[model samples]
Target: MELRDYLRILHRNWILILALTVLGGAGAYGYSLLQTPTYEASTQLYVSVRSESSGVSELAQGTNFARQAVVSFVDVVDSALVLDRVIDDLNLNESAQQLAKTIDASSPTNSVIISIKASNPNAEMAASIANSVGTNFANVVVNQLEKPDGNAASLVKVETIEPALVPTSPAAPHTAVNIVLGIILGLGLGLGFAVLRSILDTRIHSLHDIEAATDSPVLGGIALDPDAKKRPLIVHADPRNPRAESFRSLRTNLQFIDVDGASRSFVVSSAGPGEGKSTTTANLAIALAETGARVALVDGDLRLPRVADYMGIEGGVGLTDVLIGRAELVDVLQPWGTGRLFVLPSGRTPPNPSELLGSQAMQRTLEALAEAFDYVLVDAPPLLLVTDAAVVSRFTSGVLMVAASGTTKKPQLTAAVEKLNAIGSRLFGVIVTMLPAKGPDSYGYGAYSYSVQEESVSPSGRGERRARRSKTEET
Candidate 1:
């Protein structure tokens, strides 16, 4: 992934990352608190051969002897042999092997200096162990080199520069270092998880996501109408609203999307219920009708009809009534006052809705509607719930899928698309609805400028238009 992708993931999952980091730090701190305190003590010893009134040969020999013996002495201090004597003299609780674990010995490079260090639970015990090991090693070396002469035979002498002191603080457990390491590890792990999850998520949320998924051009995004509840007839009550503008844009795009195919009917539906399919169809039909072309709005979902409610008309007779020969076309046809927009409600809920919507009568009705109207906007049932949408989509010009933002699952959407594709329905595009507005980066005030202008003019313009009509009638 690119840097921005990783950044977005971090932004989206900051809480998870923070929790893990804090948990790691807390765990390290708890471990540090439970640990026993240990103190370290170290002593520096100078190892050199003692010489008489020196000759050049004697001085060179003494330096060579010191170099060779220093390594041996370091080994001896680290071994069980030297530690056994020291432990016995100090009356230590640990055995020779156990004491070796607490002791460390090292010799400086090109120098006759040796450092001995030891750690113990008590500071005084640590100091005593360091001092005893250095003093005992020196005594053993002197005795081994001694000979029966008036002057002692050539031997090495160990001189103490700094005596071991009881250390106040332990060195094994560094609280800050441990905590920092834990945080780094935890952060790394959390980021890996976030990246993996992002890679696996295939749900379409934005136009960018759809483009990336299907390599299709996103002509425009239709925002969920904020006043959809109060004003259902967006194109009529608020013709200049942004949502109305969006439907008009969709209508225009539809003109180009099917350039080669027959100019025909279109199916508007969703993967699930409450995705604004009926409202979109109603508004789109009105907008299309405003272009001075005949537009027919058909409610294909006979199970749960909403077109009549949106058009503020009766739904007792519509497509079902016409299909069963109970009513004629003119009896159910209701013109929506101004434009060429016409309403075809769902009529009555039928027990055999699936069979009726998929029958030859439904096809004949669509053919008749297509011949008379420039656009046939059919509102069908959700594809996931029933096969009515898929069946109707097969005979229509194309299908426009409506998806609710932040609520639609990727799997459910993919399944719906697959079902439509299996039946050979031409999938046009997806509409994302119910997206949140008030955010730092969202559809800005610029998008709603037309709506604001229309709202301001509607109040005054309505009164003027009414007065003009009244004056014309009186004259």
Candidate 2:
């Protein structure tokens, strides 16, 4: 994917990512609160060797010996030999092995100093344990290990250099660091999930998906309306609505389809049911009629018809009657609204819809209507469900496919297109409906309003000025 694709995914799922990050941080903080606070204290011991010679070389030798011996003494500080004495001195309740687990010993490289650190729940107890371990280790080495003969002075001496102090804060629960790490981990997981979901989802949610699926140019996109079912005739009922404006845009785009002045008849169909193909056909016809063009909207779907109901016209006799020679085209065609639009509703449900639509009579009816009207829009059944749409498409200029955003799948659309190709039918273009108004993949058109001032000559030969309100688009 490109950088823009990743950015769009992030924009679409930002709330999920943010929610997971906050939950991770809160969980880390809660874990920290449940842990026992631990305090650490450290003490340093200095080791030195005595020599009888007063020469500089002899003193250097003694220093080297003490440095080597201090390395070994570091391990002895955490041993049972010292920890057992510490337990006895402090009267602790734990065993020597358990107590040794709380102590740590280390020495700097080539140094005669050994550092002993101890940890406990109590700060004072931590300090006392570190100091006791240091004092006991010194006594064991001087009075027993290094003592030469009875009553003789010891050759090695271990002195307390830096005593351990009680730490003010605990080291185990690094609350701030843990919270930051948790947030980073959560963010990684959330981004991974978002990308995976985008890849796995097959539904078309944006114009980009439609473009990637087919080579057909997108005429226009209609924003989803909550009241679409109640007011399907948006171009007639509410002409200023944004959804209505989108139909006008579709109509404008449709004009360029037949630039050479060929037949302007088009079959409006979808891959599946409920994709807004019927409503789109009715609205586009109304939009074209508003521009003073003669448009005939036909209900070609013999199985089910909706153009008559949406157009608020009589549906007792229409396309089926005309095709069967029961009624003439002029008698069944009903004019709608104040425009030059006409509606030819499906007369009755036929037992053989595919056969009737593909018959020669159907082609003659479309040819007659195409010659009479500037534009003829035939609302057909879903192409994937039956052969009616593909059959009728042969009689018109081409098929106009309607895809619903986030509802139509890529495989379904591809199959629909393949069905048309199998029958040698032309697909004019694609119309995307039910698009979101806001988001990374929303419709890009913005609503705009402007004022136009006009000057007219009055009867007395005086100029009169008037201001008119007009909107280019509405949402």
Candidate 3:
């Protein structure tokens, strides 16, 4: 819709654009190789119509007659009779009708000069065709139009001004011109395709899309955790990993998003499942704990919980037991290693999750947790599937909606945001998941803090250090 939008489309579909350009250029080049070159030659004929007689009346009549004769001869230049003679004189293999196509006769404006042009594969043949057509027409005009009724009439004549020369080069099959035309055509097609695809695609592929859809600022774009399954304790084992760093960056963004207000408790949820909502909650809690803040990771989705599995703890006798008055919160709560992080897993799947979250006791439990911890990160079900997240958000401080970059549609994201706003949930911001590596030029700042770090080292050593840094930086 704007310049930046077009640029984003081009960036996203560069492969398609490159493929189309190469295909069009290759097709044009191959066609140029197959085309036969055609050469052209032209010869001029001048009409001589003099008005010279003894008396004034005779001179006027002679002038009129000469003009009429010249017009008549001009028509006869390409007649079947002229072509038949020209074809035979040139020893052409084609018939008179076919040879007529290669020959053309034209009279210049307000002048008695007629030009004969011919085209052929061979330069010499083209020159010969031009001369032969002119010669045959000259002979026909002198023999038939000048002499009338088998008696000598007042003469009108035409003569060749310049002899037709053999052309040195072809006039067609321009390889350079065709290649340039192909490039223009290819670029137009590629841009058209990019625009069409951008219009058709309704998925959110960038941080801009999330901001536009929800009217919320983008906190950070987190890369997909590549070794997400390799180890469950990503925050503790690989705290400096890029994936972990993203969570810490997100934590920092949250601190400054609206520092004037105090909103510590957050509900982490998405439009649908498998958008990394649970992992994001666990990581955020760990990141916050690393800052020496007491953080509680709550498995609020009693319907289906994953925080316990990710934290490598037993799921029995946790959140459900604490909610149903069967167990104490302190007894079921597990400490996450030696960090100031605590987890409350969903003891078992419950059929009355919405009722439990909406009850007054749930509100009291949230108040108690808020007093005990510095931050409470509740991992809840997807917004579209259930009202658990929305119901829980009424008691929490704010809501942080998670959305997959390419998987979440605009309409779905909008609906999810509207649902939260409809229930009076304070939306903090959106976190964009699964973005490709942001190149320095791509960001338009001409400087990434990471790329600038390489400038401190020598060029020869930069390559090896850059690789090692990338491996260390990437998770």
In the range 1-475, model 3's lDDT, one tens digit per residue, is 7887777788878888888888778878888889999999999988765555578787667656655566666678878888889878877788888887777777755557788889999999999988998988888887765655766653667689987999998987888888778877887899899889988888887766776698888777677556777765566777655666777788888777553234378889999887878888888888888888888899999888898988889998788777888888889889986658999888988789999888887787777888888888899999999999999999898889988867888999899999998988888888877655463111111111233234355666654334223333321
Model 3 clash number? 0
Residues 256-289, candidate 2, lDDT per residue (tens digit)? 8853355589999999999999999999998999
lDDT of 3 at 61: 70
TM-score of 2: 0.89
Q: TM-score order of candidates, best first?
A: 2, 3, 1
Candidate 3, poorest ten consecutive residues by summed lDDT: 440-449
Candidate 3, residue 229: CA error in Å? Answer: 4.1
Task: Sort all candidates by lDDT, best to worst.
Answer: 2, 3, 1
Off by over 4 Å in 1: 51-53, 84-92, 109-111, 121-124, 144-154, 168-172, 222-264, 271-295, 303-316, 333-341, 351-354, 384-386, 406-424, 434-475
- Lowest summed lDDT across 10 adjacent residues in model 2 is found at 466-475
For model 3, what is the alpha-carbon lDDT of residue 473? 35
Instruction: Give the Cα RMSD of candidate 3.
Output: 5.9
**Native-to-model Cα distance after best TM-score fit, residue 72 in candidate 3, in Å:** 7.3
